[model samples]
Target: MANTIYFDEAGYTGNHLMDPDQRFFAYGSVVTSDEEAKEFVESLIRRYNIQNGELKGGKLVSHHKGRKAIDEILREFHGRLLVTVSDKKYTLACKLFEYIFEPSISDINSLFYGVGFHRFIANILYMEFMARGAGAEQIFDEFQDLMRRPDDGKLGALFSASKHPDNSPVITQIREFAQYRAADIKEEVESLAESSVGKWVLDVTNSSLHSLLAHWGTKYDVITAICDNSKPLQESGEFFKIMVGNEQRLKGGFAGNEHPMTFNLSGPLEFRDSKTCHGIQLADAVAGAAVHVLGGGTDDHAKRWRELLPEMSILNILPDKDELDLRLGTARRNVVLLNELHARAKNGQDLIEGMPLLIARLTHRLNLPPIPRPVG
Candidate 1:
């Protein structure tokens, strides 16, 4: 008698974010008893006063007062809500330039921090060029986000006295790191974005689901997950297994007292249409609301839906510079790693050439398996 989780995707674009129609990408789930799930759906049907096919977030939020009704139902839900949201713009940026950013970041903090660091560096570079009176607005335009997070102490030290020539030491260090190939970082990062959405699915699911499971900590003997029917994601299954079965990769994020016990499962995963299953609709509401709230939304009908809902675990995978962690320790590991790699290689080519050996060594150091190189 294992508990089941009804999973669903609110909005998804299999293609890159450039698609004009699809704006946000979200995947989420509701874990509860079958009885509770059934009751929830029945309650909704009775309240709506009509037979319906499925509950869709896009439609649920559309009516004049539909948003309020949706949130109220969600607030009364009897299970935990977990949602992973992505910013199409950010996802696309990382996807298109995988070489510069490692899209395979394990958690939300790292993803935002890593991307933040890259932008911060770009700003420093542009500033350096401008200092030499060679800065071109168009060149900076190539990277939309070039501002450093003002709160991060480390970057603060570097950019604080940027007006004074004496602060050139910190800037020189970045230039040096930029000059070195540093373990083929740019190439590795770029390649990390190869299957754009694939990387995103794996990382977001791993964090959101793992966080949910960990919160309970061995309370349930088995967890059955049912995702909304659609094109299957390769990582969805494996990454779920890692969190449930216990994998060392989570240590990078699960450390420091927030560790969760490994979750066990009973059988294979399932898929169902939301209209047919009311539980999944509940999951969709939670997921959709989480995304809207994280987007700096305050006026939506579900604003309270974003708040009063059950155990809310919202992973806002897309955060603006303001939403980014202000502390340097936020991404200390990636920062140090990037610095190390940059210090080792003299330029991008050297780093790229030495990548195989460097990644092998780094993964070995972390006791993790290396990402496979492409085969012929």
Candidate 2:
């Protein structure tokens, strides 16, 4: 039998990523049999005397009884829940990298992408932009505008923000690349805007769905993804279908080496109304509980709820604050690495021959012991 993955989301605020009220967006999924899902819902209604005949995580975690219900649900479905939370402002930073520093524009895109230069740069940008305040906002605002209507003015403004005096060396380097290769970046944006693909980058739901599907694809060769009806999911139905049909394994790579283990998905992605589907309701509760705790829930119960997650849930927080390290120590180290890679790429040097040197620099920054030279 094919595995079923039920999906739902919390903290969705559309393209207004920097909304102060809802700073985080989350996607949640629950994997269980029909009987299990039905029983879980019924059990919650009976155990908690739920009168609404539905359970929404956002509403439940606000009080005591509801929190207990969520706790029990976690215990009941251990290891079968997954949730991905993204810092909205940080997501914009990632979007900036996606469009501004697009790797696919060049032959070496794959190399940089494989090694997670995309992510490191995004992280660096997120931290810097958060510190620079208005400058970062200008870039995000311009980028969002460009997404809506591809205009030269918006593109120029976005690049201009990158040159903020407070921006680290990495940001300055990227700004230089964007200006020098303005045509290529602009063309990429125009193509995306024309295709309406730009929206997906900022849609946490879309990214989360991709992530959840990839996770399940590793365990189940065939999956039946059932998600709560969502605008992004509805719009991307055809895309999701094609993604699974290709049976593609979304893997990561570094230094020309690809990870063998990945989620190979070949299944159908379906959407259902939460009112009718117990699975979707369960997914809502799971997503809600996650957002509650991760979004600064400081109560005693919230702490307890967090403790239950390590065993049963996979909570992925995009560009965690720790990774961004306010002190800029980590970010500065990443800048050095990016500067080295950029130098090589700019000079048309052979990256394959230079991989070891790059790897050494990265390891040394992390304070790892050096690898011994191979005997000739």
Weakest lDDT window of 10 consecutive positions for candidate 2: 255-264
How far off is model 2, as Cα RMSD?
Answer: 5.1
TM-scores of all candidate predictions against the true structure: 0.58, 0.79
Q: For residues 1-376, what per-residue lDDT tens digits would candidate 1 score against the true structure?
A: 6678777776665543434455567777777766887786676656764336456666666564446656665667535666667765555444323333332222222433322444444344434434642322222222222111112222212222223344354344543442243233344433434544434532234444555555443456567766666554434555455544432222123223234535665544566777777777877876676556554566756566556533455434453443223354323333444555455544333333444454445556555433333211
The runs of at least 3 residues in candidate 1 whose Cα sits more than 4 Å from the true structure, single-residue gaps closed, are 19-21, 92-219, 234-251, 254-262, 295-300, 306-311, 320-376
lDDT of 2 at 238: 70
Q: lDDT per prediction?
A: 0.49, 0.69
Best TM-score among the predictions, by candidate number: 2
